[model samples]
Target chain A: MPPGTALDIRDLTVRYGDTTAVDGLDLQLRTGETVALLGPNGAGKSTVVNAVLGLVPSTGTVRVLGRTPAAAVRAGCVGAMLQHGGLPGESRVREVVELVRRSCPRSWPLDDLVVTAGIDGLLGRPVDALSGGQRQRVLLALALAGEPPLLLLDEPTSAMDVEGRRAFWTTMRRLADRGTTVVFATHHLEEADAVADRVVVVAGGQVVADGTAAQVKAGIAGRTVTFTADEDWRFAGLPGVTAADRQGERISLTTDNVEATLLALLAGGRRLPDLQVRGASLEEAVLSLTSRSRTPIGADR
Target chain B: MSTLFAFQLRRVGRNRQFLFFTVLLPALFTIFFTQVFGAQAGAAAQYQAYATASMVSMMAYGALGAALGATIRISFDRASGWLRQLRVTPVATSSVVAVDVLVGMLLTLPSLVVVALVGRLVNGVELPLSTWAGLVAVLWLGSGAFVALGLLVGHSLEDKAAGGAIGILGVVLAALGGLWVPVQLFPESLRALAHTLPSYWYAELGREVVAGDGPALLTVLAVAGFAAAFAVLTAVVLRRRPLHAVAG
Candidate 1:
């Protein structure tokens, strides 16, 4: 019904011994969409990535590019950059790049891969000698060497600096625009908001919220009402207010029904002083969404 | 597979530690043992006899480094998550192990050849060209057991512990296998214990070749058995707990 489904994961569950990591999660992505699996630590982000790569045993139906993860991998359609792994030591960057490239059923030219990853200058250097940020770029190049249609990166920018992160995401955007479906896992709210076409917020191994960044930020509280409330102002008991934070002369209230809360505040001859109302920022929305995990607050899928 | 082998060979070639143990140290041992333990030139026939056997032992010792070298690389790769990363590629997991095994065997050749050269030139151990060639061939072929053992050790232990474990194992194997000390000098009970070790069979194969005899059928079978057994154990262990570098 849509442009080929890049990824379709249904009821995916992963367990290690007595502990369950991912529980009944469903996710679908379209070709060329830049998606982020946004979550805090231990939110099953890596497990989901591992499942998509067929690296861990799990109960799930995960199809990448219309094939099983392993089959897609064999077909050279899925390339992944794991969060933590040391590249083979005693190897030059060029050798590592060529090694992964050769293993792919479909590969780009070495020059093209290096240029795309911006690691051409580091090719002949030993991998062990590269700095952390430099190594991440080299690994990114290695992942792209196969010309895979689906690019999965787990915390790709973790080792990068601010400038490196900005540069890395730019390359990702360029690649996505050219038809590669990019899926990355990160906890950085701003990254999800700025870089992802769709943000899937996960907490406690379940999809807590999933939508465009704007929609996810508006899913739970919808908006925040902030004003400088002096003492003796009891805002916590206001109508439709789910959360209230007070700091000195500033008070911020997150409300599902901003209109109702505003009306009630101005009722009884009380003035809504220094009033401010705005949609929640991605950070506020995510914090509220994750903390209310017991409720399973639904967002547009 | 060839690409993997070639890539791995380059990596192994650059590992200074592997090169030292596989080639340099063994060459040094050949000269050290032959001169200190064996007869010099113009010595008695019994002296020359002892020297040739010691030279074969050193050659066997050198070949042993191949397995140790292979073990270190495999374990390090496992611990570092390199193997896990390769799993996501199109390459089959079994192919990586096969490549590692092949690399391990290839690495042994340098040690075997260098040790034999040192034995001939520096130690003045005399042997026909054919005999020297045969000794190298037999020992090279025999090193598969060590490589298999290395693979098992790699799978069984983490990288940090693997190095020490294999080093001790190599020394113990050399001592009991009569590579470091002649089994003839061991008491009757200790020599019986040496018979059970694959390294003993590996060295005996070389001694048999240098003694102007075909490698003993039992010795060949023992070496092959060790390779097969260690390979099976490695497979079983890997299937149970793969080289998963990081837990989720």
Candidate 2:
């Protein structure tokens, strides 16, 4: 409820018939903060976001800035880029932006936002004619039309390619820098790692972990070490190393203690080539945590 | 509600495709049907009544389609996550549905006028002052019913295709309800089936009014009741399903 906190969700739960889509999830975002919600498919990340927007019903409490989602929307406190391209077919990119601007009492200039979102070249194109990445940009432009204090995005870059995704991340960071509180939900851990100042990993309708990206990585408690050796590395007896394998010249090790393993390897007089120790990439962290907690997304890896 | 209403109306108006389907197509059909049936005297008389009634029904039916179109819009929006984006925005959640209904109404008005005019000019149908008033009343009642029906259809269908299927069915109901020909011409069993339909009730009321007869007050009551019932049914369904994706 404090000023600049675009969203405050507490113990939120949402159910559809017998299925509980979101269970006791808590989330918060303040101005200039870019928060990423990371989870595999079926995680309640989207449910929580929808509940905060008032598009879906939820039990518990959700306040946007000091008001409920509906109230906040009327007060111009939130902006969103949902899965559906906010731009309708038959509508030009410029027209959609202008329309949203009209709905918003305080609106940004269409030309300026068009350029900022890198949609200057797409202004005259009908929404349906644009490529997926272009449509994504237009959706962002629509959401940002009012220059709302809070922004909610559900897979903002899911349809974009590598370059497009990277560009969108930069745009998102810029928005946060300009005082927009952003909460984005995505299945791609790498995207979350690249853009999210804070990451919340949701699974089985619950917040399994919530903190900075480093904290989430640390919570998983393992590092990946890949090195090349003459033969397969005998990692069966290594302490703190949970798993290890060799692929051709590459030796991969999963260890709970990276420093200790490195020291032990060095002491063994084993001259390893191309040895690299990584605490955990967002992808590794999510997979390990989800695998330990629930159904192993054996496929995601 | 006002701002949301205004915003939705404008947004829908900008959808050239939906606007064409909701208004332009129906008016063109009204003109075409009136011309096609202009020759036969009895058929002309029947057509006149049918055209008037169908025009009203068409508004309700098309309004229903447009309303469901909003559902399609929502489903697609959510599918890719646009609805989620809007949720974080300052737009009121209720505005989504509110705007859809208002857009349906805007699209409904022009079609109603086109049908009335075509019926009078091409079909030589003239009505008394009370009949004119009754047409207005029936259009409102029928429009309300279909609007609610559209909401229910939109909320209940998981696939956008199914939502569209419901819209086409609205047009089919027109033929079965005697919107193209008098229900009197149908087989006894067919007539009985049509009589039980809300579409039939709407057409019968339009026919009665066009004959310079004031429809029984009960007719108005029944139409209004159907509208309220459908609206409640739709709201309840929507509450349960919320944003489930419709068949694309």
Candidate 3:
């Protein structure tokens, strides 16, 4: 483990009976970095977060700020918002926050936490009376009560509406800007794209792709080009074009090099009309990468 | 830990089910049993003895019910994922359990006082101040075993099942422990069976304290042994089934 690293997980494996939830996963995060763990359902994203929080028993080691996960928790250096956990329904919102604050050695002021969570109106309401989105905010307040240096959130916005999601990310951005190491696991591709500085894509309990958002997108096959042209069999033979299809006057081509394909199309004085270029979206990139047979594409470390 | 205990206490204070079992029912039983038996006993001294015994029995019932009701509360917390949420914090599991036990004991106090007051004011039963203190102390400490039993049951069963199980266990234990009727009124064979239960020892302790004599050494040892055994069983259950297993 390197000094100053916010989280270091090495060869972590979690199993349930004969099924493996997380298999030999290794990941590290530096201080002040916001990383997203992205995967489809049953892809072990929540498992990794649970392992980091020491909530599940797993083989191998996990360290937060150069200490074991349990040690960091004891020092009040880690906070987590689990995917499906709920607050005490009988307790009022503020009282629940106060109860959590008492467990930490250092905690944010209750007023500040209430404001950050945007739960001022919910302070006096019983937890059971709150809506799903409101309850999530209360849980968020409890997670922030410790004011920990490391925050691990597993699908924190799954229960939120559009407005709630936007407000939640705004709070997260502020926390990350204040030098808190934030690692969140989310299946929402757009959420990871919008909020994460770096993205780690996991499939079948392994890190399939790891890099900045643009880098992970770029690591996928390539772009696509479409143009209006006469039906011809020769377009498929163009350089950098992997596949080509012609239907009437429209031609679509998938290419590894968009520049080279365009150059080839125009080099022959081919009058291509209505030409368009489209880059692969993050969703497409994830699908293509995970669908492969354990292909470690662009897993550059 | 104090905050957790205080929060739990406040929740219990508002819980209608807890109030019904721990306070209202016990007070009603104390009043009803004393009225019926005290009027029929004829002799003033015998009437006083019956009223005291009824008060003690009702107090024991109330304390045991509160301790077992704690299992229902814990089961709800576990089902709702609150217990698993707490596990992620810096609070130790043992500290949480300690707070639970403390809250259970606190819930018993109101019922104890109410029953004792009923015995004194309504039934004209009187005891020395020291005896009152000693009886309360014994009942309070003896409740630790039931608290441990609550924890064990909470961890072992699901939410609704746990509540039903604790309720049934409370009634059965009360019947066999001679808290509902005097042990002397039972047949020899039933009395022998009652002597084998931990509840009997607790009831005997209360009787001895009310009779102006200290609890026997064997009774005290037996109660302590029950507490230790239940505590160990709780620990074993917790190990076999971790809190996160119930997480949503």
Candidate 4:
């Protein structure tokens, strides 16, 4: 757990016109952990973040640090980086930071926060002049301006390049280590996998899967083994192994029963060599979880 | 809240376009209209009175533009997710709205000065010291009324194009109210109809002050009544359906 209870949403329902954007969705973010909210477009991820910030009207219970989102804000408990470039176009970055500082009782220095978010050089520039990634970095800086114990990031790195994103991931880890709870929402599964301590897959406006990286992957039902053998790999032909790929001396096997695969490998009739057992990546686990819940990619399952 | 109000005032000052429309442009319009109409307008005492009153009322309407620009900018804030960012800050949401209202009021002062200068110098309008005091009161009342109106429009229409529509509406109301031209010059029947408009009430307030009658205590009461009504009505609409109702 991180230092703060990042956010707690229970039975939150949001309606826009006649359509329900979020229906009875429940989520919780623990202290010192980065929880990645993964969902397709219109899956209520942003809505959940908005509800936690009290930006929109909604029905249901939401608590950030044991108080309503607005109350929590007044108490200096939470901070956020919402969608793309959430800043006034004409405002200078320093001016924007100062404005945020006025709203928050506790805040970091404008220069330090800017540097932390990798936008120190952009302080004098108008928001409209910044590149998309630079603008995002500035917005992220503003979110960190208040030194909030809990932070909500809705697609914080969506505009960043690979290197910028990697830098941001280091920043996130540092914040988490200092006990700030983080709830990050993004559509990019690989980024989520690389950075988030826990991955929560959301679909149909509900949380479909929630667990640590390895725990989530383990939930998808198989251990994969890849090896190169002097002779043909003995475990390749084992029952309960659903997939076997062989190319020259290399063999890859996916097994439904890990115990059976390991025992067969130990039998050694084909002299198994250089064997390695691998768990599924978080991306694969998320795909499998979402696929089993609905459709994998194109069609609904 | 005062801190946020100060910050918002700073933010509004950075908007060059808002300053142009609400301050510079209105002052220029007063000067230009008075120059074009001055000779014929000065011929009749009542026309001179009408011209001066119109100039004064235009000040109040310019104040309305300040409110309108602030309101629309707040709507933009909502759309850009700045409002959301504010919500998660230590500042209260009421502070955010309060800052805008306060900034609108602060910006209105310079605009009123520009209109007064145009009326006295460009239109050759004169007023007693007491009349100046009354003018301030009437302008404040008119401004309060229009700020409320701006709030209602901004709350109801959150789109950028809708802001233009409301800006046009503000200008039309001012024209009908005699901010650009006196309603007295219009036909009697039309003047009678104009009297029913809120802008006319504002214009009338200025006319009475400059003409030395001053607004009777009862008339002042009536202006207060109008301001209160607008404020109450706008507050109700805002309470019922906030601009970012869909955001959550």
**TM-scores of chain B alone in all candidate structures, in the order given:** 0.94, 0.77, 0.95, 0.85
Interface RMSD, one decimal, each candidate = 1.8, 5.2, 2.6, 3.1
- lDDT (Cα, tens digit) per residue for candidate 4, span B164-247: 867787877777766666776788887877766677776667767777887767566666676678778767866776534343
Candidate 1 chain A: minimum summed lDDT over ten consecutive residues — where?
A: A292-301
> What TM-score does candidate 2 reach?
0.75
Candidate 3 docking quality: incorrect, acceptable, medium or high: acceptable
lDDT of 3 by residue, B1-248 (tens): 88888888888777887788788898899989888777899888888888999999988888888888865788888888898888888888888888887887777777777887877887787999898889888888888878888888887888879989998989988998899998899999999989887788887888889988789899999888988998898888767676665221
Give residue B8's lDDT in candidate 4 (0 to 100).
65
- Candidate 2: where are CA atoms >4 Å away? A1-6, A15-23, A27-30, A84-86, A187-190, A201-221, A224-254, A258-284, A287-301, B1-88, B133-137, B158-160, B244-248
Candidate 3 has a TM-score of 0.86
Task: Give the chain B TM-score achieved by candidate 1.
Answer: 0.94
Score candidate 3 by DockQ.
Answer: 0.36
Candidate 4 lDDT by residue in tens digits, A124-221: 89877989888888888888888998888988888889888899999999898988888888877677778888878776567767777555544555
Q: C-alpha displacement of A69 in model 2, angstroms?
A: 2.9
Give a tens-digit lDDT track for model 2, residues B180-230: 666778999988888666667765566566667656777767667777888
Ranking by DockQ: 1, 3, 4, 2
Q: What's the lDDT of the predicted structure labeled candidate 3?
A: 0.83
Clashing pairs in 1: none
What's model 1's lDDT at B98?
A: 85
Q: A141-191 in candidate 3: lDDT tens per residue?
A: 888889999999989998999999999999999999999999999877778
Q: Runs in model 4 with CA error above 4 Å?
A: A1-6, A15-23, A221-301, B24-38, B41-51, B217-233, B236-248
lDDT by residue (tens digit), candidate 1, B2-38 = 9899999888777787788778987887777767766
Residue-pair clashes per candidate: 0, 24, 0, 6
Candidate 3 pairs with clashing backbones: none
